[model samples]
Target: MNNQYILLPASPLFIAFSLIVAFVLNLMPWGQMVGVPDFVALALVFWNIHQPRKVGISVAFMMGLLMDVNEATLLGENALAYTLLSYFAIMIHRRVLWFPLRTQALHVLPLMLLAQAVQLVIQLLVTGKSPDWFYFSESVVSALLWPVVSVLLLAPQRRAVDRDENRPI
Candidate 1:
């Protein structure tokens, strides 16, 4: 008989930390100057691209709900947009995961746009007026920031030669 133990990856505590940081960033007093992009969304996209199994739809939905509570928006507005975006992320996760960083940015940019569009539609339906165009501008900035955030948050570790005991010549 053969015995083996299956090990699972640890839960992403960094993702939870990122969510809190995003909320704090959102709450900062920018005051119509130095517009802030969606930090949470960027973080989510980064994690989903790197660790979809750990940061899947349920995580996005819960984070979105917290965002709504912090931002004091409608209950389900961000939740719905986030859930849909997460679903889209998961569906393409395999391909996106393997893409070069630049190519992944190209793919994710449009998805961010789509998520923003969904949020806009929901806002229009609920509030009966469009938000300032600057709100949409965040999507562009967020997309542009994805690569930087991905590198900062998910860059692969470079093992030292001494750490690679089994490395072959």
Candidate 2:
């Protein structure tokens, strides 16, 4: 064996920390719950775009499951939404990363909409009522927060000049 292995740009520690922070943001006490940012979903999208190999669909689904239980929503609603988000991230990860942050935001907005749409459809099916238009404000806010989240998560990561050494990683 050559004993060579590829290293990721972001450390797993920072990744997990960022995710925790995202979760915290989502849980923050916003007086109006209508437009709160889907911070956890944004974090998942960020990791999926930047670190797809490590944070795959399974991880997103599990996170969604946790969110479902925590929010007392339909059991699999968030799971399905998250899985769809993860799948979209994995599918276009390469393309998304090739652009500037602004452009990437444009690209990611649709995926965020899709995830939220999935939840809306599921809610309609289960509850027999359509969610109000305000529900989608979260997607818009999350999209606008994309650059901030990207910078926050990626700032600590430094690319290696040589793959042979692993210090900051």
Candidate 3:
């Protein structure tokens, strides 16, 4: 059976809170573990798709700048990557919303890959050193996490229960 939910409008405070939380998660010292997903990218993509008006490229750029400062990389490396990610997510958000959660994950995979690719390219151009093959694994993990991210991010906006009676919502 199909169990679609009618989500309430997302709160701006909650959106900011979620993005901050994602940034904090990224700040955690994971010691460069391979396949460690970028929580900031995942959250950015989710919000960009779900609420394009609320979370746009400026937000992505700011977050990316924060990430660059935190990661000690060249400034604007992550800004460019995340700006492109938000742009791409916003571009196809309508079509993505038509798919099932699992299928949506498939669509998100490429966006994550694209963001990573942009950052990787910038890093290569600046440092002139190539990363290991495992560098791409982060996108795969982020893609695998799309469903979870969707559920968590949308939780605050989801209707608690469906009305079957006089509430024609």
Candidate 4:
């Protein structure tokens, strides 16, 4: 059996679970001085990098719309940012996936920054003023969290590897 071709179920349950987790994290009360990290963006980026075919631009856009509604920000601000971010992720998916986790983190940092910049620009356009630079701090925190998020999300696969290694070969 070709491991790469193995068909895993695209569990809607997991998708819903991820989105709910993201929403809950976003809704948590954080100080104005210390912006909350973007959990949805982190999750979306992790899934998109790991399962680009399943979590593509459309999923990102939809997630972004939900985020916009949840955050009560401009209607399309997050949607546009997410769509662009998803596209960028997909474009680099192949190369990014081949790198070490630390290297991948470096690669994704710019994308995270770009996504935040886009969202900030949209908010500025809508409100005629920019948000505090602190809001963009979430991207830095998100990038820092990427390796941890990737490890957590990839735990099942790692366990499967361990199981295979322990099996008769």
Candidate 5:
């Protein structure tokens, strides 16, 4: 098989497990912070970058729904945000993946903000008021944590290079 076409080394089980863990993290009590880092968004970005086919917009939408319900926010508030988030992630996935993890954090920052922006827009439209800057703290927190999230999620999926003669096809 062509190297470029070689499947990414992620398993379905790992993907599901990571998303579940992310959702749990998002639901954890955070003591009335201005904004909390969204583990679900981070995990969505990671899987969408590495395995877009298996996990993409639909997964993000569902996760967003769960987030909205869990957080008792406006219905579809996070779903819309997550949908936008996954779209942007899929758009630049290949280029972002080419960079080192820390550098990828820089690239993902805007997308994180955009996702939050979408949420803010929806909130504003529904309430006829704009959210303050603190409403975006979650994006800042999420972007800052991107590299760490990448490392943690990719740890189990990394594969050693096999430089010797090719083994069985």
Candidate 6:
């Protein structure tokens, strides 16, 4: 059995569960710390890449609205960033899935950076203030964490190592 070629269809329940978990992680206090990755954005990109039909722009928009409310920032700030993230992720999903996990991380880096840039631009326009340079580090850290996030999120979809000869998928 070739491990790379076989995977169970992702369960919708698990997908929702992962998104909820990512949202909870975002709600954690560490979010104020410099270089803290946006778990919700990471999860949004992951799901948009892996299950585009299941988690589309509407989901990203809603999640962004949730984040905006939680952070008390401008209401549409995250919504716009995440919507663009979902759009770009979906656009390149086919190409991205062909790469190894590490390479995929490289591909994801720009998307993360784009999202942060959008947020930063919005913040600057609205507040007339710039965040410290370290603000961009969140995207780099999130990209670095990509492979781990990919493994954990994909774990449930992977089949048992030993194949059952009697059963047909």
Number of the top-ranking candidate, with lDDT as the measure: 6
Q: Please state the error at residue 151 of candidate 5 in Å.
A: 1.1
lDDT of each: 0.74, 0.84, 0.92, 0.78, 0.85, 0.93
TM-score of each: 0.81, 0.85, 0.93, 0.84, 0.84, 0.93
Report the C-alpha lDDT of model 3 over 97-167, residue by residue, as the tens digit: 99988999999999999999998889888899999979999999999989888988887776556657776
Tens digits of per-residue lDDT for model 2, 127-159: 999877698888888888888878667666644
RMSD of 6: 2.4
Candidate 5 error regions (>4 Å): 1-8, 159-169
lDDT order, best first, reads 6, 3, 5, 2, 4, 1
Question: Residue by residue across 22-99, what tens digits does model 5's lDDT show?
Answer: 999887888778768888998998899989998999999999999999988899999999999999999999999888
TM-score (C-alpha) between model 6 and the true structure: 0.93
Clashes of 1: 0
| Model 6 residue 94 CA deviation in Å | 0.1
Error of 4 at 58 (Å): 0.9
Residue 129, model 2: lDDT of 92
Worst 10 residues of 1 by lDDT: 1-10
For model 6, residues 1-169, the per-residue Cα lDDT tens digits are 4435567778999999999999999998884688889999999999999999999999999999999999999999999999999999999999999998999999999999999999999998999999887988999999999999999999888765567998543
The RMSD of every model to the true structure, in order and in angstroms, is 6.5, 6.1, 2.1, 4.0, 4.6, 2.4
Report backbone clashes per prediction.
0, 0, 0, 0, 0, 0
Better of 3 and 4 by lDDT: 3
